[model samples]
Target: MKYQVMHDSGPRLRVRAGQWAFTKEEGYGLASLLLDQDFIHDVFTSYRNGSILIYYDGEVENKQRIFDILDGITIDDLFEAEPTQTQVSKEITDDFYWNISGMIGRRLLGKWFLPMPIRNAITLYRAIKYIWNGLDSLTSFRVDVALLDGAAVTGALLQGQYDPASSMMFLLSISDELEHYTVQKAKSTLKDSLALNIDTVWLVDDDGEEKQVPAMDIDKGDRIKVRMGDVVPVDGKVVDGEGMVNEASMTGEPLAVHKTNGKTVHAGTVMEEGNIVVEVYSMNKETRLNKIIDLIENSEDLKAETQGKAERLADSIVPYSFLATALTYLITRNASKALSVLMVDFSCAIKLTTPLSVISAMREASDNRMMVKGGKFLEHYANADTIVFDKTGTLTNATPKVVDVIPMSRRYKRDEILRMAACIEEHFAHSIATSIVNQAAEEGLKHDEDHSEVEYIVAHGIVTEYDGKRAVIGSRHFLFDDEKIKLTKTQEKKIEKEATEHSVVYLAIDGKLEGLICIDDPVREEAKYVIEELKSLGIENVIMLTGDGESGAKAGAKSLGITQYRSQVLPEDKSRIVEELKAEGKTVIMVGDGINDSPALAAADVSVSMKHSSDIAREVADISLLSDDLYDLVTLRKLSVGMLDKINTNYRNILVFNGSLLVLGVMGLIQPATSSMLHNLSTMIFGAMSTKSVLSDRDISNDIEVEAIQVADAS
Candidate 1:
């Protein structure tokens, strides 16, 4: 295994091994080997070119060690892989079977013709373990439900009621196992929902030759060709060809989008029509499903306030159960009555059901292509009164089109201007830049890289030297104000005439006004409907923020029926606006999809990012919508509200039913064994019910109609 250094820059190293580097099995094997080493921080392998990019945490001295390890690797030493589901199921099944066998053995021993002394000794040993657990809880000053369960079982044993004690312990063991099974089942479903099943892909090489290869072997910057019925294997930009892509996996949209050259495409999206050649940007990017799973697994710390209250209330009632048991003994002078009081504990049901309901709701969200980071985000979303949306790539379609290209100089043609602009814009990934470059490609305007290194000014424009002449393409402020390029009166009138209701990107070359490219960014089809739905869901303030001019914002707002809008907002201005809203005591849910929106996203009570959002924006957001549809926001709000409602309903039912049983036990109306059996039965029943799906067809229809009616009435 010999390798050549392809790139070396500080902690990051890129190494390639001739033509034998990456096979599907070998790539994963290599990644596994590198991940096992302490010096390596991350490893990304490309099967297309047999290249590996490694990021390490240690000093340059560790580089030699990494090379040594790579040199020592052989084909036979590669680790074998197993399906995750098989491993998970085997482990769970083994544990379950072991527990079932123990329970069966206990039952058989009791039924067999054993000596009375030996049988009594076995029963005593089990009772002593329960009593010790109860004593330990008391010593720690924690009056939990466990202490009550142990006390009831111990009391029954002490009173020579062996049957009742054995029954209590058996039911408890079953309850514990059932809880474990429920959680594992939920997790399994979630993992299956997020799994990517890609096996093979069509790879296009530098010479424009195509061949079939394993998906894992595809590398960043490799050209991959996809046809109708094929799922895109990586996130990339379309370099050539056109297609209608059904992005339901990412955006939840049922319709296919018309994607062409220069438009960005994502992994798992199906190409429904035509063909496309995509230049891969990220191979093995983190999937939304994996992120959601991480969130669900680590969400215990982010419990809703209601869930915390339920737990606190459960703990608070423990001492009351103990007091009632003592009083019952003093008044009735019967150990059975006191034991009944202890057996019907309320804390167990309250603590168990709340978290289960929250987790179930999260799983439901994942099914709907929404990833909620924690239970607390759901709570915030439900309570949000105001919703703020970034105008571009959120409410409007991110892929704007070039409608009119105006050239100032007779020396430059519209297509020539477009080709030059596209050549420079191809280096950047902004939505506007993408639109310019894509439009040029559609018109078959091919231009080579004739410019020097381009300098990108954030939120301003691009500066570069083309053909030994200074060239600039950006906003009016960047060209006229920053670069001091003057616009003639006649040129200004032409610009004004062409810029009606469209965003204009100015272009200048050699200190002279070259031309402008006017882009039309239409509002998303579902944007207005989503806004109406939010109103019906009780969102009080719906506002729009944009970096565009006041006229543009006003036109967008008027069309969408949004009354509150702020125009020409900078990155920091958006965050300030969110802060101001928060100061007004409004819970804000901000939706955005660009790097500029990251600050405002962080400032919101809860933030949502679109499927096509920039990395920084998504990283800061609490929720990520895998689709570009705004309707999912309404869907999410409904799910969150329904979850809170379900939790509250369970709480009420638990209190009423369990409180009644406790009262009946205290009055000696029910026997100790009967009370314990009924209480455990109800807890198990409700716990199972808590895992049910939150959304129903009827609920969705009703909510949609309600929103429509509200919008009509307001009109």
Candidate 2:
């Protein structure tokens, strides 16, 4: 291979592969090879300039290793490489316009350039296929849009109006082409959104040294090192080190889970903090991400009620169209008048534009980092009157910070208390634990594992041994009631004063109260504004449900201007509340990001999971917000409402326009040919309009934050 370095910077390099890179095939091949390199983070190839850009995170000393690898590679290597799914999808989508243009050119040549007899014969042949489809519908006892189109063409041919009959068939062909194009474009956008591009990982060798290797080369029992912000490339168990691994991509829970020796991790999840060495249990098999892509590809069953109704209504109108044609013939004793009545049926435009509008809105929502599962959920979200939010991760920021540390034990200083807390806290993966450990690190408090084996009690706390004595850290109830740790009157009073308006984690040693860590969880910056926008958008009830104490929940609700909130609510109680609201005939939307909120997410009329939500919560949710911004919720609502409005507008416009065409044809003011042409032309026009974005510039700019607005525009 021959190349020249065009640009070089830390961790990034651009080079000209050769003159052959001017071809797309050569560029893609080079990109595919570079992307497979273990040290490379990303590869961008430009066929126009015969150049390739590579990003890597390896050591600076290993920079020359990249050039050495490329030196041994040749264009022949690219020919043997398998094409990625993303590349194939792009190729297919790009070819759509070429196919459409060819079809239109062939149709025009047949109609205007071919001899009259040959053109008429070809028109008759195409008309028979449509007529057969109509006959099949009739035999199946279904009246549909196909029947209406067949009747129009048949009437024109019987009256010896070859031009109108050929024109009608040609227009129907164009309508079919437009529908196919819309569907393919939507699928391509969705496929691109869900793709996972992890190709390499750092493998741990027998000597305990980490070496960069292609993910495909790793197998069972191999150890790999996953660092913060790196997507796990294989399903494995922790062998050494510890970290907070975010399994939201697999579990739908927004918070990262703690991974230590012997803990299991899955592929596609990211390490949010620290680093871990994992022993691979599985590699290169079906991943959770692939399942999500499958779900998106096979989401036809999730269509909205309006879409189904439009389809049914289109079928139902066919009989009425037949009767109208018969009535027109009886009144005028004219075939042309009867043909005119058949030419302007409303089924085509109504059925075609309805789903197009819904899909286009879904694509627009995806642009804003909101992945809606189906059109029905979008409709449900738009109509939801009441919204129930999980207070911990939904309304407040998921990241909590230590506000105060109250040391009660005379044997230990405050710094000693924090050092012991961080040692144990680092063993767990919760917001409280993260806050404690982070605070200790910021203060430069370091400690060896002075504790013995740590055991975690779900929803209670953690227990271990310090200096052969029992140690515990958890909630007030977990310490006082479960562990029976007694608190002195002075200590109780101190806790009441310091932890009254914040979340508190208790620490006890040898069955005696030692210290308390107070945590403050600030509300998200956009929470208040998004809440107000939801109300303005017609949400009638906004409520918060939390497992936090009354004071904490009340403060959060008040700060966000929410009037209704239920504190000390358990997980099941949250679902019960959602169900109770639904029992009252309220359409409820539940927003949450933890395992506790999974049941409620499933119980709601529509549910949204934040980007960091637990896997179970995400699986139960109808929509997933890809960013930690409440403004996306507002954007989603506006997009859903806009979709409904667009559908309604299409219906009204079709009715008025098509109805006028029918009347004019019946009065002999317009010929049957002109009526048919106008009818299909209008359907195509509305279909094209349906693909336009539902969100206006003003709506996006005014409601969404500047950074988010820019992301949407870039997408």
Top candidate when judged by TM-score against the true structure: 2
- TM agreement with the true structure for every prediction: 0.70, 0.80
lDDT of 2: 0.81
Score candidate 1 by lDDT: 0.80
**Per-residue lDDT of 1-715 in model 2, one digit per residue for the tens?**
7789999888888888665544676667667777766788766665655677788985676578888877887656655333466555555655666777887899878767899899888888888988898888778877778777777888888888888888788778878877776666666655554455566889899999988987778888899998755677777899899988767557655456889999998876777566899998876535556666667676776688889899998888888989988999999998888888888879999989998998889879887789887789999999999999898888888899999888897988898889999999897767879999999999999989999978765456889999888999987767888899998899978877778898788899998988888888898877887889899999999999976667777788898999999987766688889999999999999999876676688778899999998655655678989888778888889999999999999999999999999899889899888998999889989998988998887776754564564466559
Query: Which residue runs of candidate 2 sit more than 4 Å off their true CA positions?
Result: 1-31, 34-75, 80-89, 188-214, 218-299, 409-411, 458-460, 480-491, 612-620, 703-715
Alpha-carbon RMSD, each predicted model? 14.5, 6.6
**Candidate 1, 1-715: lDDT as tens digits:** 8788999988999999766655745676687678768888777665657788788985878888898888998767766443244335444565677787888787777758677677767777777777888899989987887787778887787778776777677677776786676566556644553445677888998799999998878887889998755667778899998887766546544346889999988876666556899998875536443454456554555567777888898888888988988998999898888888888778888878887788788878887888776678889999999999999999998878889898998979989999999999998878899999899988999999899988776567899999899999998877888999989999988876777577788999999999889887898867887898799999999999987766778899998999999987877789899999999999999999876676788889999999988644655577889866677898899999999999989988988998888788878899888888888888878888888888887654654675576578679
